[model samples]
Target: MANELTEYQQNLVSLVQSHELGDIIKPLIKEIHLFDSYISGTSHLKDRSVLEKIAVGDMLSLQREDNKFDSNAILILNEDGKKLGYVPEKDNIIFARLLDAGKLLKAKISSITQKGSFIQVGVGIYLVDL
Candidate 1:
């Protein structure tokens, strides 16, 4: 898959290797765009205030929620460890599989919209090579 890396990823790899702590630092290589969609069920979060504070470009974390009703459920959380919502079930099958396989993956807020009494969070999921 080395040949498949975009120019951006190549430059990132080079930049990381050139740093003083390059030997130990694991730079994230955005390998692929795994999914792009709104985080589902944000309206259900107890703390809606967190949604208003988050902005686009903020880094988010994903965790597999195996005990959830949906076996493929994945939880989306903010940098502060607050539960934001979830990776939509329809788009989480492959992501869950990748996470279960010990592959590195990450999400970043792509957009945020205020809808009446609730907030909608859009995220871009990417496969990362450390």
Candidate 2:
């Protein structure tokens, strides 16, 4: 048969060709987990030089803990399983909910700053397609 396509297939092809998929499916920055001075495990980061190498999109792992003082506490860890800090209480509510709902959420180190007494690391929460 001569090259042919159904009406639906032709429409889909035209749509794909006409639109930039990147523009349509951009990753959303849902929450920014800013490290607070009171967050546990941060003291260890003071002597650590790894923070300097952390990049914008470096993947961070989150572990939800129900027994923690903050019921919504989510432990943030680096790739090597080193505990970075906890997602700030203010931002953990929705993050915990999303995790409970089994959404494929990924956390990344968005920014890092070394201030007077504490090192501030901002974790960006994103809903990704795996």
Which ranges in model 1 have alpha carbons more than 4 Å from their true place? 1-28
Question: Which pairs of residues clash in candidate 1, taking residues 3 or more apart in a chain or in different chains?
Answer: none
Whole-model lDDT values for every prediction: 0.77, 0.60
**Leading candidate by lDDT:** 1
TM-score of each: 0.76, 0.58
Error of 2 at 91 (Å): 1.1
Compared with the true structure, what per-residue lDDT tens digits does model 2 show for residues 2-45?
A: 53322221223224435686455444313344332223457566
Candidate 2 least-lDDT 10 residues? 5-14
For candidate 2, the per-residue lDDT at 61 reads: 70
CA deviation > 4 Å runs, candidate 2 = 1-41, 44-53
lDDT, model 2: 0.60
> Roughly what TM-score does model 1 have, to 2 decimal places?
0.76
